[model samples]
Target: MALFKTSNPALGTKTFQDAAARYGGAIDVANRMTLNGTVNRTGILLICAFATAAYTWRAFMQTHDPADVSGLLMLGVFGGFITAMVTIFKQSWAPITAPIYALLEGLFLGGISALLELRYPGIAIQAVGLTFGTLLTMLVLYSSGLIKVTNKLRIGIIAATGGIALFYLMEIILGFFHINFVSINGSGVIGIAFSLFVCAIAALNLVLDFDFIEQGVNAGAPKFMEWYGAFGIMVTLVWLYLEILRLLSKMRSRN
Candidate 1:
């Protein structure tokens, strides 16, 4: 099996390779991954995420106080992070861990979105609309072969994603010292442009993710990999939505 680098860590070439090797030479028919199965599983995970998000959204709507939901926000952020790490390393556990991760992220997104919505108004819905619209457009393009996932394309996207990740890691480390990357986070022209670039990159990552999942299915990966693949797609969707929300917020802040 040939492996390719992808911006999304969950659907990397090594993931399929490792899964194939672990399952031995003969692929199990009853346990083989299918595209339809992955789609259904992804739907389930999205529902799980939205359910928790609605829960948090309702709570925040009632109190309208950031302080009231601070604890829930923290739990969602840290808990989601921990669960994501576990699922990444233990891919086989995705069936169990993916929903947990989704549920936790919903809490975080809902709380933060509620807070931000109070400031900007209507931004959250706009972000969600754009995110899903972008996803649909990209899916159509990929399906139509208008956007080919070539080796060069994958390599470029993967490299750019790594650089962005490093930049964010540095930003987080610098924050402890009260330093900030205003150039990238502010509402100035440069900041807006930066967010646009990041959002575009994130949207492109979905294409790579789609390719990765298709390849995994063709590779006859284990049935459990359907859940793992869905988890990977959800990760990208979450990142894409957050970036869209951030971009919208920055644009709104300037107004």
Candidate 2:
């Protein structure tokens, strides 16, 4: 189960070649930027970001009780996040539904941040700063070509992510039964170590997202794809941010 790096409908074949030929390259096989290419879709990414941030702020501001807000925020956050993935899996509705995903996720995050801040004081800001730093660092490494996004790597990421998701699902089930085998971050040194490892995997996924965008542009995917592309990037970023937040919270608890 690879992480699915490229959405090449062509599957690397002659059909893709014929389609590219007949359609004058609806999916640009060559890497070149057109005025209306995927690069343009970046605006959609910004739009999504603004929408998310605004809603999140609204959710936070509306909350009067810290613990109550945190609990609801967590529910909404997980709901929105899980919903986005399910929506994307539907494929046909990705464009329309993905934006809604962004909006909901924003509200979820904003409320969660407010809750965390109320309880932990400055954890929210610290997490944001740390998340940004990791993102920037990953970007620099990617732009310099120090890290390559190979098909194998993508597959590995997808597989690991699936494993992690499975563990999380189990944790959720056990939590309901009042059975606590796994810590929120994992238990003891091993749990903490596993959290760090998972965090690294999440960070590496960012690298894959960057590669996918570059590949899409080079292939000359449709201009509309830019929005799709940006949306994809946002998905990865949001995931990364949440994981970072969780990791930080666990560390704080330890201290």
Best by TM-score: 1
State the C-alpha lDDT per candidate: 0.88, 0.62
> What is candidate 2's CA lDDT for residue 33?
32
Model 2: which ten-residue window has the lowest total lDDT? 7-16
- Stretches of candidate 2 off by over 4 Å are 1-47, 50-63, 66-95, 182-187
Model 2, 102-130: lDDT tens per residue?
A: 66666667776766666677887887787
Candidate 2 shows a clash count of 3
Counting only residues 3 or more apart in sequence or on different chains, how many pairs clash (N, Cα, C under 3 Å) in candidate 1? Answer: 0
The candidate that wins on lDDT is: 1
Which parts of model 1 have CA positions greater than 4 angstroms off? 1-5, 24-27
lDDT for 250 (candidate 2): 73
Candidate 2 clash pair list:
2-155, 28-219, 31-218
